[model samples]
Target: METQNYIEYELVDSVSDRNIMTDSREEAIHAFEKGWTVYEHHNTINQHSKFTQSNLTVTMMWNDNPEFQGS
Candidate 1:
């Protein structure tokens, strides 16, 4: 929906520019949440097959607000 939301350009009064972003833990948490939300089925899942260690786990890359890009 976010991708298509820009269709009505006039409705969007203004756009904001952001510089740098820093991610605390939301990146990892958002991925985990998306997987379980069947209603929103917009999903992201990661597998660490190369990491044979049992302790290894998949984590989503988080970028803090402003830039919305990976840190």
Candidate 2:
């Protein structure tokens, strides 16, 4: 077996702590446009002969006005 890499987008309401995952940038943007904050998450899984390790990476893209708070 080989290492597997994965990437995903997250649309979050920072204040409310509500979030959803998306498969593409476009979907993330759309969610952000609808008053949700957007984030890009990258994941890497390394497989070894004995065990595996997984790492997560995240980046903030867009944030809506705090006043709105996912209205």
Candidate 3:
């Protein structure tokens, strides 16, 4: 399955803790930890932005879901 299943929302301005949504009881936490590590290395904080800011930008293309057209 693709993680592109949902719209990649701009998490920059979001106020809520991402960990909450990511918490599938410790399992999800661990998954995210691994993913976050990759995410950090992949999107190093340049003189530009944070990991979530650069990497979490909305994907204009979705998984063929009409509901995510603007995503």
Candidate with best lDDT? 2
Stretches off by above 4 angstroms in model 1 are 1-24, 36-71
Comparing candidate 1 with candidate 2, which one achieves the higher lDDT?
2
Candidate 1: tens digits of C-alpha lDDT, residues 1-71: 44421110001111232222223234333433433211111123211111112432323232223221323
User: Which residue pairs in model 1 clash with each other?
Assistant: 22-64
Q: Which ten residues in a row have the lowest lDDT in candidate 3?
A: 38-47
The lDDT for every candidate, in the order shown, is: 0.22, 0.52, 0.28
Instruction: For candidate 3, write residues 1-71 as lDDT tens digits.
Output: 53322211122122342422221224433443445311111112211112333543222223344542222
If ranked by lDDT, best first, what sequence of candidates would result?
Answer: 2, 3, 1
Tens digits of per-residue lDDT for model 2 on 1-71? Answer: 96667767657776788878777867766676666766554555221110012222232322333432335
Give RMSD to native, each candidate.
Answer: 16.5, 12.8, 14.2
lDDT of 2: 0.52
TM-scores, one per candidate = 0.17, 0.48, 0.19
Q: Which stretches of candidate 3 lie over 4 Å from their true place?
A: 1-24, 36-71
Off by over 4 Å in 2: 14-17, 45-71
lDDT of model 1 at position 70: 20
Clashes of each: 1, 0, 0
Which has the better lDDT: candidate 2, or candidate 3?
A: 2
Residue pairs with backbone atoms closer than 3 Å in model 2 (clashes): none
